[model samples]
Target: MNSLPKRIAKEIERLMKEPVPGIQAVPHDDNLRYFDVSIEGPTQSPFEGGNFKLELFLPEEYPMAPPKVRFLNKIYHPNIDKLGRICLDILKDKWSPALQIRTGNFVILREKVLLSIQALLSAPNPDDPLANDVAQHWKENEPDAILTGKDIVRFSVSEKMDLGIRQAKVD
Candidate 1:
């Protein structure tokens, strides 16, 4: 409880001063530990021309534990589940206490996740996926899967789905 707040405050200050490329994150005024985040879809991925929203919270154990993060925007990715839960090793079983920063409680939150997800966008790992059907589809028919993912992006935009990243603000 003590370390978490101080850490989060430092994190907010850092991010505000040096925002990450393609990603912007800010903590809510009402809840210092809960952040509203946005990540631009990578340029060459099916999600390009889009913005993705996410919510991240520092748990009580914090650096000793990973932040609870989930996508608020729907995306067509094999490593992301229907509920927007991710199957990334860093976010899960591989999380390291060394990720903790003496500077902030946020860990290297935005950078690591952004880079990894960007990499995932460029080169999806279908062998291990949170969305099983999508993974199987990718494995069985790579080209068709790519086509379908692209189609989904187009349709979602036309349909005005809640796929756009929510503006970062105190909520």
Candidate 2:
């Protein structure tokens, strides 16, 4: 039928055959229009070793517009709301047809965004946020939280390993 769903299915199939590195997108079996995406956390970021799941929906008017993407995992970042909604220019205000959502393109975008998110986690931007409370908390109480190690969850996997080793040595 070459319907929107069919076209998306075709794209998904092609992507699966020639998978891209860093990120992946696959159909959820139950819904072809919806895709389950997993992005590996970028290195040198607080989210390293953290695998994030996301839901991508291809609208009927896709190709002409950007697909709807939302995180299914909990993430603490300036550009991502507590609910996991991303606030990227490409996903929101600056989407264009020139941007194709192929497997390669998706992987690139995911990696780039994750890098930005890592930077944001290190230095949050509360000027614009989907979760105002999170932003406010970062702005008002970040220093105290850092001092108390309250908001720190061992962001990096290597950091966790190092901490474990140090504790083992002390013990």
Candidate 3:
């Protein structure tokens, strides 16, 4: 039927075959419209050395409505909230159905957006932040903010890893 769900499944299949380096996303068998993704932190970024997880879900009205994407791993990005919601323009006000009509075009756009997100992690834009307090600190003192950001990133990720190890030991 080439419905939204079908198109998402097709795109996800192609992504699996030609996967991006350091980024992995695959459909959940129980929910083809929902994707489980993991992005390796980019080198030299504050998020570097941390393994981050994310989820992307295609809403029923997707293409007309932007996909719902959020970080599952704790991150300290100004553009991302503690709950994992992102404040990216393309995922918000800039979505257009034309971008997803042709499967090939959709693939390209998806890749581009992913790359842009990676870049965002490498160099956060404090001026356009979703986390207001973090943004304020970043704007007032850039160097200190970077340090604090890295500290938070390290702490959050390490805590998650520790919890995982504990669970493994318990089982």
Q: What is the TM-score of each candidate against the true structure?
A: 0.82, 0.64, 0.83
**Candidate 2 wrong stretches, greater than 4 Å:** 1-10, 101-125, 137-171
Instruction: Judging by TM-score against the true structure, name the best candidate.
Output: 3
What candidate 1 gets wrong by more than 4 Å, as runs, is: 1-4, 100-107, 160-171
Model 3 lDDT tens row, 1-171: 244456665677678788888788777877777878778779987778777788888788866788788888767778887898888878888877666556545564455456667777888888889988878887888788788768877897789899999999999
Lowest lDDT sum, 10 consecutive residues, model 3, at 103-112
Local error of candidate 3 at 72, Å? 2.1
| Native-referenced Cα lDDT, model 3 | 0.76
TM-score of 2: 0.64
Worst 10 residues of 1 by lDDT: 162-171
lDDT of 1: 0.75
Report how far residue 121 has shifted in candidate 1, in Å: 2.2
Best by lDDT: 3
- Each model's Cα RMSD: 5.4, 7.0, 2.9
How many residue pairs clash (N, CA or C atoms closer than 3 angstroms) in each of the candidate models, in the order given? 1, 0, 0
Off by over 4 Å in 3: 1-5, 100-109, 160-171
